[model samples]
Target: MLKLFYTPHTSALATRIVLEEVGAKYEITLIDFEKNEQCSPEYLKINPRGRVPSLVTDSGVLTETPALLVYLAQLFPQSRLAPIDDPYLFAEVQSFNSFICSNLHVAHSHRMRGHRWADEPAAIEAMKRKVPQTVKVAFEQVERHLLRGPWVLGEQYTVSDAYLFTMAQWMEADGVDPSSFPKVLDHRNRMSLRPAVRSALRQELGDQ
Candidate 1:
């Protein structure tokens, strides 16, 4: 069985959605940010970076949402969660995930995680104030180019969809109007309707 450590409303939700989509038998351990459990020594042992979405596998542990999504898709190829067979298509998937991880996610982080990049209060406030524009610009690129349609890679429902959807959920909180990006909003709505996505969300949000 696979074990996943995660917190609600975080990038880990992408990994959880992939796990559910793959029908993988797994259990999740929540690391409550409110309680600072993520910074505890025990959790630190599991993930040296003390980040959520750490997957404990038979071989070892896997961190990072993009890697975990790809691993699960490849592990259960029958699910067809990714286009692993095609090098180009698979690279496209990787490219999209990388953008979410390196660009979009980082943009969102600046709103509250300004401390990660700055110590001066003025610098932190500046980053926070710039979040709206930076995040809007980042999503504009997705809206105009990166987002390939119905699913990130066009008709196919790849793991990239989950990753994109995860970040899309942050639009409002990041101060960007989701309506500004119709395609991304539509994709988010479509993904929300997926049974696997719903199940993962319900679990994370403790929805019943």
Candidate 2:
């Protein structure tokens, strides 16, 4: 069986969604990231960076969100989460995945870690301004490319959509305007409508 270390309301939720979508049997071990559980020695042994969503597979321990997603997709090719045959489409998926990790995730992390960024009021205020601006551009590009979708990658659902959908939910929680990105909004809705997604969210909420 596969073991997943994760946290609620985090990128781990996205990994859970992908696992469910692929019908892969896995056990969830919650890590309280906010409580600093991730930085604990035990968890850090599992994942040196002490991040949630580390997958313990037979092959090895897989860390990082996109890398884990791609690994799982390759492990279960029949799930069609990635394009194994089309190099171009695979590149496209990788491109979007990178955009989310580097652009979207990084900006949000900066905002979340604003205090650590500086003690000066001016520096903190500057981060408050710049982080949102960075996120705005990344999301705008996402909004532009999302085309008439239930998914970011078109008709078929992929890990890319799972990541982006979760991020969109974060954006909503952050008071970001989703109305401007109609396609992304619709994508989020479609993802929410998935039974597996519902299951994942319910589990994350400890609904049983």
Candidate 3:
């Protein structure tokens, strides 16, 4: 069985969502950030970075949500969470995946995990202030890339689309208006309607 060390509302949520979509049997180890369990020696042994998401497979441990998403999609190609039929489509999906996980995700980290980069309170505040502008610009670009709406790569719902949805949910909290990007908002709404997303959010958020 696969094991995933995860925390609710973190990028790990993207993995949980993809796993559900792929119908993969995986166990989740909830890392309690509030209690500093992620920093414990046992957890650190698996993921040196102390990140919330660490995918333990029979072959090897996979860290990074975007990579895990692609792995899961490829593992269960029947889910069609990613394109295997055409290299061009697959490349496009991977491209969006990189932007969401590496680019926009880091921008949001400025708001919540500013200490990772800066110690001064003023510097942290500056990062926090940058969130709205950065997020807005990123989503505007995301909006522009919307091929025909309903998903990141148009009609087909892929693992990368799930990733985009996960990150887009952070827009409001970052002080960016989702309404400003009609296409992105519409895509996010479509994602919200999927059973996979609903299940992931329910499990991650609990009764709240």
- Models 1 onward score TM values of 0.97, 0.91, 0.95
**CA deviation > 4 Å runs, candidate 1:** none
Query: What CA RMSD would you report for each candidate?
Result: 1.2, 2.0, 1.4
- Candidate 2, residue 201: the lDDT equals 91
Question: Whole-model Cα lDDT per candidate?
Answer: 0.92, 0.83, 0.86
| Candidate 3 lDDT by residue in tens digits, 27-117 | 9888989889999999999999999789999999999987899899889999888887899988888888888877789888899999999
Query: Candidate 2 on 26-62: residue-level lDDT in tens?
Result: 9988888668998899998999978778999998899
Which tens-of-lDDT digit does each residue in 105-195 have in candidate 1?
9999999889889999999999999999999999998999999888899988999999999999989989999998999999999999999
The CA-based lDDT of model 2 is what?
0.83
**Local error of candidate 1 at 66, Å?**
0.8
- Could you say which candidate leads in lDDT? 1
lDDT (Cα) of model 1: 0.92
- Rank all candidate structures by their lDDT, best first, as comma-separated numbers: 1, 3, 2
Worst 10 residues of 3 by lDDT: 145-154
For candidate 1, the C-alpha RMSD (Å) to the true structure equals 1.2
